[model samples]
Target: MELILLCHAATRAMKTGHFPTGDEPPERDARAQLASLHALPDTRVIASPARVARETAAWIADTFEIVPAFDDIDYGRWRGHSIRETGEREPEHVAAWLADPDARSHGGESVAMLAARVAEGFASIDRLDAGRCIVVTHAIVVKVALAHALRLPLASIYGMNFAPLSSTVLERASPADTWTALNFAPYE
Candidate 1:
């Protein structure tokens, strides 16, 4: 079987001299999840190129043997902007984004773009061995992929909470297969 263990995006930029704080995903204990996962024999970690994911992989590199791949949607002009700034400057735009993330922002990627990137990320899974493969990607990427796995409409992605620093195991009988809601967020 093959398992894609999705991880969330950069919850901490540390560039500000402190952890990046926001009303976003959860801030998890990396050490706990790393110590736990009874990962499969052929398990390989694929993480987004983002710093948080990269550093996270570094902590567990020897155990997981990670390879960098996949990235989250680009927020473009909103890249470094915080929620307060965005809300104040672009109320209508923010509302629209909340309503339908699939709608492309002026300079950022739409949900569809993210879905395409995730599709590209999964391209290598089939040719590999049948054991588990853990892919540590962004939160939005996780939602998009899970939505793809569940065959859920892309529009509902923002409504879901794909656990940060968690695993949504996708075990299967064979590589040429698919399923929905295999196992929701399991705590660390």
Candidate 2:
């Protein structure tokens, strides 16, 4: 019942800051990133449909499989807006949203919504294994999953650094099936 979550490799889309917003794991140094994660032995993987995720998962070669349920939080209309544009166009709204991701974005999913979806996705994986199963997904999605496990506030997602190519291990022991956040944002 142990689940390992890994954020997708960094992508130019992340740097462009206005191309990918939904569940898409933007393309980046994934081919290289895969090498680091794949080195670990005996890992079961669940991946999102994002291009970058799919590409990265390819290298693992049957190690981690695709589970659409593991896709990222949907950003809705604000999907591809750059941070600068968002801040400039809606300063106060942006600030408040940052303070509380639960606040809905321009026609988009809220933090609570994100948390709910991520939980459902995680629950779907509960039966996949008795040990660790690595999950490859987007940053926001990973954080939401982490938040659900730790019972953390959504506003706190900002302070948490979810850099690309990072790893977090979430464990759910058998019987009781309680999930615990073992470690977060491991820079590896």
> What are the lDDT figures for the candidates, one per model?
0.62, 0.70
Off by over 4 Å in 1: 13-29, 38-40, 63-69
Pairs that collide, model 2:
1-130, 11-27, 45-64
- Per-residue lDDT of candidate 2, residues 1-188 (tens digit): 66777887777768777637544445545465456556345567777878777766666555557777677666666667786887788788777766786687566777777777787886777655546577778888887788777778766677777877788887766735667878776544
Give the number of the best model, judged by TM-score. Answer: 2
Who wins the lDDT comparison?
A: 2
Clashing pairs in model 1? none
| Model 1 lDDT per residue over 1-188, tens place | 65666665336432222223323333444655665554445667666666566656554555544343366667767765666667778888778876775776546877787787676666666666757677766666778877776678888787877656666777666656775446767545
